[model samples]
Target: MRRRGGARRAPAAKEGGGAPSRPPAPPQREKLAVSTPFFAVIGLGAFSAWRGMFSLDTVRVLNAYAFLIAAPAMVLRVMSREPVAALWNGLFFAAMALLGVAVLACGILLFRRLAGLPFPTAVSRSQCLVGGNFTFLGVPLMLAFMGDRAAAPIVIALIVDTALIVPLSIGLIEAGRGGGSPWRIGLRLVRGTLVNPFMLSILGGLALSLSGLVLPEPVDRFLLFLGSSAAPVGIFALGIAAFLWARSGDLQWRIVMPLVAGKLILHPLLTWFVLAVLLRLDPLWVQAGVLYAAVPIAANVFIISERFETGSRPIAVAIVISTALAALTYPFAIWAISG
Candidate 1:
């Protein structure tokens, strides 16, 4: 059977066969080698952050491409192969959606109890605490640890969380603010969410997943090749964003500290708790939550603030500090919850 997101088939264990017909072991070993470069990518980000030279926004775009570009492309290929019955294997996606919403809620609750901060402070902190650097940090990290094919679930998670979870949250949060027209705002939101690249990709991927559809050989290779670029290039963009942040030096400690704690510690725990307790997600999913949990705050928080005159100081600081501390926290989180 053909698989999604990769050209490399796994090596099945041979029965009492005289000689095995396998795609050379070297390729398989090389496939796992993807892990090595991922570490290098992380190191590059960390180093770039320290040196304060590269462009962090560039990293952001790299991340944007995975969800914005590669994800949809891969989804098209994956969609081509799914079976009818399996197309509705949406339990995982639905579960993930709940997890995203829950994390946002947890961030708000934690912010209130721990900090007693004001509205914008709370909003900024909650946004960072809830919505992670899912695209930039999570993608590379997952690709490194899991490799290309296995990264599909996390990619799906990324797309879903971005297109559906975040937009909905923002829409609700802004609903009471007395905009031009509530109906108009609602309509805009619907259109925005519907046409969202990430959401569309998820739908496509889910269709393919359920249908058990297979892609043409050339298409599969192309998807794999593009999907594979996600980690390294994305990390580079993150580094560039960091450099820009460093140059700005607009660090705000008030919003920063709590954001760091909630994102690095509380968010992951909330994810694990929600998955294992509330949703009772499978172990693999629980692991996915754990891994994705360690992602930094979105760089967009800063961009949105800077570009639209909104404030995301808390978001920016969290992005910087959370990532810095996650080096220690992530592995511990995996060890603590995963085993």
Candidate 2:
């Protein structure tokens, strides 16, 4: 009887002494919960790319809606509500932009010499390293994870990119061609920045914010409704775009790898160091800056490369790879910074 009783108690003790199997489930569940939204957006895009769901015309229409209507409305609403003071992070913006340019300049020179790339190819590839899909990918992702109120830094970064980095990219491309005069390039830069809908929306919003006048209830509500559509539409369109580009045949691995690495990894790492460690910026601002830095190469890089007649294929491949990979990297970035 004693032996039987001891055996019974031993089994109970073993059960009690073992780690609880249920405790780990919640954390895992929470992680999945956090990641679900991101994947849902990507999945939506992927679904749209499937046959019968979205055609090329459908993608174009969705992109136009997001760019011309939804995004601007969202930007206007957010910027109008945010204080003008919060939008002016000149030091941090300048530091981050200048650092990005410097890094890309070095990359251009290094690839030119070491890789023996032609000047136009080097310039195009370097632009891929520096530019990011901040508007479509970064903006929506920022609004999703950080909320609309936390988007001022991202807007500031967008302005800085348009104002400064873009000119540098164009200048480099033109210089490589030995074609456009410096004055002509400078004028084109100014025109391009001024004419950009994104920039215009930001400026208009800032003006409204600074004016201290509240938007009427109807207008405000309308803007809110329109702005709400930007994220889902933009992300879905991005997914379709990625799917189309990825099927565009073999990549120039030599050029694509370095440019993709620089855009997705090196730029964000350097931005984090400069903003988070050196400047000790607001934690929110640092996260936004780093997140923006980590976005995939912009599609415009291909446009620029094409205009200059160099490295367009490599740029397109880099954009496709970086955008696809960002689906994984973005979640990790949010987790790291949020934690």
Candidate 3:
């Protein structure tokens, strides 16, 4: 019978005896490796803070650089190059918006009932728990670990969090405080959102992309240079901020522990379930969603807490503890999503 069809082509594995192809190291391990440098820079910042290398004024200057210059430049550069089509990842956007709203609502209700917090305080606490530091911590970590594929998704998530979740949460807090009228509060939020640096950069970039206009080579290079500084500087400032918070003697374990659990564990678990298990979006988007979800509470949350005369102390503690714990949780999140 033709020698039994040449022995079934000699089983490919036996044919070469090439040692089972060694199932390429667990993805989590690879992901952890990729994130090492980013974490190291952050650690360096913390170490510097511990050493008293950064004054409050110095930290403020660093924050200004990252927020006003580096971050906007980076966003502008990245958004300008992205295909207009990349902005319309409908499933990703829906998934993010759903997650944000669900988490915010549930968090508010839970904190209000379980903690017996006042309505305004409950709203502020919920905002702190859900509003991740995607602008500084998430963007830098993603760019460092995922490379260029991270740019567009990061921007999309930022938009959702910045334009939608943040403004909504803040508006609720303001309303709970019995602010002027609901309409006036909303109008103020709208105007402020429009003028925000992050929003401005996103709008400008989209406008450029829509117009099909390319920046001059030198101008583009300038943006690239400025944007490159954003990652390190922003993360470094965060490190210092964490250091300061830890020394403040304001961290109530009762409050900080629960908030940390919510942000570092609960939020990411929900995101993975929705994006990876349910929707089954592209792996990059899934990774992006999970990573951002796992990020620590935003510094802006503390600002919001202070502005509303809610408890900024608890918010600050949550930021420090959650970020510290993220070194472990983030890699696991990556592994879970990838696997």
lDDT leaderboard ranking: 3, 2, 1
Q: Please list the C-alpha lDDT of all candidates, in the order they appear.
A: 0.59, 0.73, 0.78
Q: Per-residue lDDT for 306-332 in model 3, tens only?
A: 888888888888888887777777777
The local lDDT score (0 to 100) that residue 132 gets in candidate 2 is: 89
Best by TM-score: 3
Error of 2 at 81 (Å): 0.3
Q: TM-score, each model?
A: 0.73, 0.83, 0.88
Q: Model 2 scores what on Cα lDDT? A: 0.73
Scanning candidate 1 in windows of ten residues, the lowest lDDT window is: 11-20
Model with the higher lDDT, candidate 1 or 2? 2
Task: Give the clashing residue pairs of candidate 3, or none.
Answer: none
Which scores higher on lDDT, 1 or 3? 3
| Tens digit of per-residue lDDT, candidate 1, span 225-307 | 87666555665666555545645667777657767776777778877787678766555556666777766666656654454
State the RMSD for candidate 3: 10.2
